[model samples]
Target chain A: MFTISLVGPPNSGKTTLFNKLSGQKIKTVNYPGATVDYFSADFDKKYEINAHLIDTPGIISLIPTSIDEIITIEGIYSHPEFGTPDLIITTIDASQLSRHLILVNDLIEANFNVVVIITMNDILARKNFSIDENKLSEELNLPVFKIDLTKDNGIDELIHFIKTEVENNFEKRVINKISEDTFTLVNKYNRISEIEKKVLFPTKTNSKNITKDFNNLHKPDEISLKIDSVLLNGTWGLLIFFLAMSVTFASVFWLASPIMDLIDSAFALSSESILGIWGNNWFTQLLANGLIAGFGSVAVFIPQILILFLILGILEDTGYLARGAMLVDKPLSKIGLNGRSFAPMVSGFACAVPAIMAARTIPNKRERLLTIFILPLLSCSARIPVYLLLIGFLVPTTGSLTAGIILASIYLLSIISSLVAAGIINKLKNKVITEQDHSSFILELPTYKIPRLNNVFFNAYLSTKSYITGAGPIIMIFSVILWALTFFPAGIDNSIYNENDSFEQELIENSYASNIGKFLEPAVSPLGVDWRVGVAIITSFAAREVFVSSMALMFQVNISDEDSIQKSLLKNMQKAKKSDGTKVFTTSSIIGLIVFFIIAMQCVSTLAITKKETGSWRIPILQFFIYTFSAYFLAVISVNLINFFGIA
Target chain B: MKVRNASQLLNGEQSEILGIDYNHPSARRIIEVGFTPGEEIKVIGKSLFDDPIAFSIRGTVIAIRKSEASSIIIR
Candidate 1:
């Protein structure tokens, strides 16, 4: 099969042309290596070409400084599994012709079957400039096609040309590896300048101001500079960045909640109706509570994931994300992270799974790993319910102000902890192994363009789909395991239930999960929580948000309405007592539980994603054990310290 | 004609590139992005902390750290 790969410099409209050609709904993120989408699609019959098109990450020169560039270079010159691509489609931005042509020169030197597709000709034309296509083609000794990607001008001619080339089945071109030393690069740049002088012409000229006009012509667009003046200003830029982030995050929560609640209720209703019909057999239990529940766990995250990517897509498309990264780069660098780490870390506040996936954009492997390692420590929205419930118990009658302050403090603490952890881990890793790949911050602030809505939606949909397919199965399997742990050792007799003990409570008390909790009572007792809270902790390992529902079940709170689940759970928790007649959910114990939830790596979905992104189980396994134990130890210490202070 | 590292150019100041500090780690990429000798570059903007400065080169805006910009000698 003839494979044609699309290669180009960053912000050269390569992916846009690829999308137009293949009619595929792949997203185009601007940052190199940020997106792992290497889409290969068959040509449409309308094009009359039996060829496969591979869209690689946007890259500059063949001498790769980053992973994305390396991938692009590899895809064209030497793919491991598929050898060299038969034809390389190098997209050059006509607006930045001279610099972009350097890549074309490198490809020509390497003797690849190169087809130059000049994109952004319309942008160039708008600047009162035009490229002489025939002269460019003659100089490059290749078929050069200039097409306006925005308006789809000259596309049919390019398509027909490609079709003819493919049909001819031209002789294989042998790779001639060129020396990429500094001298060669200089020569290539010099050569590109000569070609530019020959083929580029002024569309509208004034002889009187030719020199000034020529100098100013190469400056960046007026609108982008104007917007950047306000947006990249030291104070206004950071302020707008925070405001934009808050809006995105607030939308992720608020916009996704309605859909999430609908999904939650839908799953709950399905389980209840199934129980009503099946009359409570083990099969029904597995179907409704285990299988269905697992599916719901996976489905529940779709809204947040979609909403996050959608906003990110818009931000990325508008070219503001690059500026946002530049704004945060200095602060993040103090902790051994760079600008690229900002997006993923902020996304971690929504959920760690997608946040880890977003870490793919950081070109440096060590920095990427550090970002992923500390991401789960961020106070994600999933822990909000647990925090709220615990905060209520800790200070039952306090006004909303104090509770809000406590919640904010918890968030602040999580952020501080992540930063400190990153600093320490980075130091440790550097000491253990010297890294040669120095992280560099060379980012393009692409000209701002109004985001195309279809493109933004497609990006969101593709990313959400990938997350479901990538981490969905592991979440489902683990959800079933958790279900089985709580569901098994079944048929604890109805007769075993006392007057005060509900059948649900009796069943839970006799389940394997409860047994594990009983076994861990000695370990948890120091933290002032009993076997029941221990069971809640174990059940919530599937997801931190499960703590509230698991606690309701353990306490037999009989929450008939969703609105009052918290109120009833709190009331039951406040009254619940141990065998020694001491009350559970005391102030110190609740604080400990809150701290535990804040720090513990309890979400199986996060673990699954960490495993997927890192392509290894060793890191996830180590992350799980290290985080959970530290959370426990910290909880114990907090509880003891609080008690010693007479806070109880 | 006086020459200084590109990092020394004040914001909104324009200069023609003299050459790159070849020993710097990121020199190759900087040169590849049209920071070669004789190219015109303008310091368009500076970040909040003024470390990673944004420059307009080849009709596109790019941001690089002061450390990397220091390698690009210009006047």
Candidate 2:
């Protein structure tokens, strides 16, 4: 099948053009590598034959620097699996024609069947400049089509031209025949200047100044400048960034609750109805208690993820994301990260999967790696439930202020730990923060434009879809396996229970899941953790939030009563005693458990995403070991030291 | 006009890039994004530390660090 690759420089709107051509709803983020990798779709009778339209990483030059750029280059030239693409659709920013044309010249020289689509003509036209299309085509010897995505100008012409001309002449132009001298960065750019000289002409010579005046052309600059005075003012910029992030964080909690509650009740209602019909047999037990509950627990977080994406989408679309980057770059650079790391690090507070994906915006290898390495330590919402359940035992407080302080402290702890980890790695293993890909820290702050609401909704929808699609099956498989492990050995007959709490509690104890927990009891017993904590730890590997629910189930807390669950779980854990009759969650033990949760690499989805993002198990493996060992030793030492000193 | 460091250029001042310190780390990407010699740029704004001073180059507003900007000689 013929593949047409859409290649362009950053900020060229390549993804928008790709979505327009492919009739797909893919989102376009402002930063480079926001898509992370190529997005391809088959022709849906939008053309004559079956062809793949691929949207690659928006790269500046052919010489690849970062991972995303390398992937794009590989897709075109070096991939062992996918052969070279047939036609190249180069998207050029019309206002920045001189710079954009350099990439066009490079592609043309490399002998790719090139069709240039000019975007942002409105911006150019607003500036009293316009390109003569036929003149440009004659100069470049390739068809140049100008598109206005909002209005659909030149799109139909683009399709018809590509269909006819490409079919006739492109099959044989596979080899790059242009000499090194002909395609040097200097030569291509020099030729691009010549083309600009020939084709680009000023329109409507200003009535005031008959010359081409760039300053007067950009009327929007006044408003933008005025806005930036407050928005990008150092102190105000920081304040606004904090406010923006706080709003995003607050919206995740406030706006999504109704939908989340609706989903929870829906799942509960379905499970109850399914159980009502299926009776109390094993099949009913598996469907009602296991599958429905398992999937529903995960499906509830969808709203929060969607809300985060919606806010982030608007921020990026409004071009405020770049300003946020600029605001944080200096501080983050001091800590061995760039401005790009700021967004992903903030996103880590949401979830690591998407945050790791977001880290691709960082062009520096070590900086990107450091961002990913530190991301998991950020106290995500998944850790919220774990913190709530554990902090109740750690400190004797249900007060609002104390709870808020504790929660904020955990987040603070996460940031400090990750920064320390970055420092350690810098000092010991890799000297990362000192050397950089670019000597100058240059980040483009796009002009403030009204964010297109459709794009925001589309981005949110796409982010939620991807998370569900990527993380769902693994969660399901783990849930099912967890169910089977806790259900098998085929009998409540093994442990005798007099009442409801004991019945559910012993049901897990006599099953295979508890046996696995018992297997790790020796390793954990030193930290004052019982077999139940062991089982909760094992179950939470699916996701950290599952630790709370799994604890609720293992302790047989009344799941039906949401209002009383937190109090009951704390009460049950407080009453829990070891085989030797010593209390399980003594003050020090609870602190140790809290420390472990704060540090341990317990989430499977986090590991999966880390492996995918770093493109190797090696980094994730090191990450896993470093985190788990630190968690283990720290927990053990805290427990032992407190006991030795008779402090708690 | 005599050449001066990009960090030394004041707000709203327009200048052309002369060159950058060849040995600096960010020199390559600086040039890659049209920061080469003869490129016209304006010092639009500056952050508190003058670390990330904003510049308008070829109609795009970009922020670069003053430490690295010092290497970017402009006149």
Candidate 3:
């Protein structure tokens, strides 16, 4: 089969165009290398023989600085098995054709049969710019197809053109050949100039029309000044950014609530029904307690995660994400990061697993590592239940608004700590210098179209499925082990100490004196945690959400009539005390614990991603130690400071 | 005195492009995308960020870099 490669610059809607043509809904991200993996689809028609359309990485030029670029270049030329692409389908954003043509010229000079796919035709029409198709075809002597990929316009025409060309084996006459010497040299412009005079001719009719048109349009200076007035010096831009983020957060909570509740209730019902049928056998208990409860914890969070990804994906698709990056670039850069760093860091708020994977977009290795290292500090959704549980008990005394403020403040603190940690690490490593001199605030602000619902739901489903399949097994096993640890030492009963309490409370009171709790009691004393909390922490390391399920299991066996796990946790925490009779979960200890979790490298999936990205255990191991030490040290200081202020 | 700004170039205006701000992200992007100085470039269109601007050069429809675009001294 003849191979045709789709090539373009980064963020030129190449993937979007490819998706439209190939009928594949590939995930499109804003940053470069988003499409790190290449894909190919077969095109077979009665009128034309079979052809393979391979989507390659977007490259600026043949000389590649990044891995993505190198892969694309190598894929085109160095394939020993596939040989070379028989044809190159170069897609150019219609509004950005001048820049797009550089690659076209190179491919033409390389002697590839090149067909230019002009995308974003709607943008071109809006700008009132019309390409003289015949004139352009005569100038380049190649077939040019204008397409609005998002609207699905001109697709059949494009396919028909491809069919006709392939059938005819159409080859454009080479009017200007690049010399061997010119090809070898680094001066790309000098070589292009050498060929330009022979291939290009200005038409009198088009020249007159262009001059009249130019005289009528707003001058470039006026437009630049207008942009500067709005973006560079205006509060409106910042306000828009914040407003967008607030809506994003609110939507994540609001839209996902119903779905989340449904999933939660379904699991609860299934577990209860299964327990009723199977009775209290060990296998039944495992199924009810281990599999259902453990997976349910993660499964419940999927709706929120999906909504977050969907909103993020839409912002990315609409091109507002680049603007967000640009707006925040200067501020982030002051702390030794860039605008591109924001996406993965924000993603950490949902889950650090994908956030760590998302860090691949950062070009600088040190920056990438630093971003991955500090991402866990973003107060991910896994911490929400723990925070809410503690906050609810304090709200009556502290006031509900104050407690909410404190909770929100802790999240802010996590972000600040992440930045400070990143800055400190960058300073210590002596790699604080920025190499991105080519930082352009300019972004292709794609026309704002209503976000496609199918695209949104499809992405959400795929992302949620991956998380369930990947993290589900680990969480289940961890919960089982935790259940087993607390379930043993069956003869020990604490009914005498809490005689007035129900059978469930008596069981949990016994659990505190269990062997597993006793083993971990000493280690958690400084953090003001008793044995039960210690066991919960250990189980949580498998996955952060497992903390909730572990607590649920602990409480489930201890209390028979407690309807709400949230309420039970609050009540248990309120009565809990330290060795000296001081409250175990004092305001200080609560703050300290929250702080520790915010900074700690608690997620194993994040560590796995680091291992995969770095291709070694060294970086992940180093990250593990650094984040753990930081979490511990910071938590200790916070607790001491809060105690000193008598805030507890 | 000579006019160097991309704005001075009319739509469908053909010019022998002299130089670009290689340090500019748009310039680098354009170069990376496939545009080189000394090529015959035709201005196709422009939008926000002075972006999605298109060019016809080297027998293909290539998009111009949005940043280094203003610095493209064309005649």
Candidate 1: tens digits of C-alpha lDDT, residues A399-425: 477886797789889998899877877
Q: Is model 2 an incorrect, acceptable, medium or high docking prediction? A: acceptable
Report candidate 1's fraction of native contacts. 0.80
Off by over 4 Å in 3: A1-4, A10-13, A23-53, A71-87, A109-113, A126-128, A132-141, A148-154, A161-229, A232-235, A396-400, A430-473, A487-516, A555-562, A577-583, B1-75
lDDT of 2 by residue, A364-407 (tens): 88788888887888776667668877777766666467766776
Candidate that scores best on DockQ: 1
Order of all candidates by TM-score, from best down to worst? 1, 2, 3
Best by lDDT: 1
Clash counts per candidate, in order, are: 1, 4, 30
RMSDs, each prediction?
3.3, 4.1, 6.9
Determine which window of 10 residues in candidate 2 chain A has minimal summed lDDT. Answer: A27-36
Interface Cα RMSD in Å, per prediction: 1.0, 3.4, 9.3
Give the TM-score comparing model 2 with the true structure, all chains together: 0.88
- Tens digit of per-residue lDDT, candidate 3, span B1-75: 766756556555777766665544345444444345555666654433334344545433343434456766666
- Write down the C-alpha DockQ for each prediction: 0.82, 0.49, 0.12
Ranking by lDDT: 1, 2, 3
Query: Residue A245: error of model 1 in Å?
Result: 1.9
Cα lDDT listed for each candidate: 0.80, 0.74, 0.62
List clashing residue pairs in candidate 1. A34-A361
lDDT (C-alpha) at residue A91 in model 1 = 93
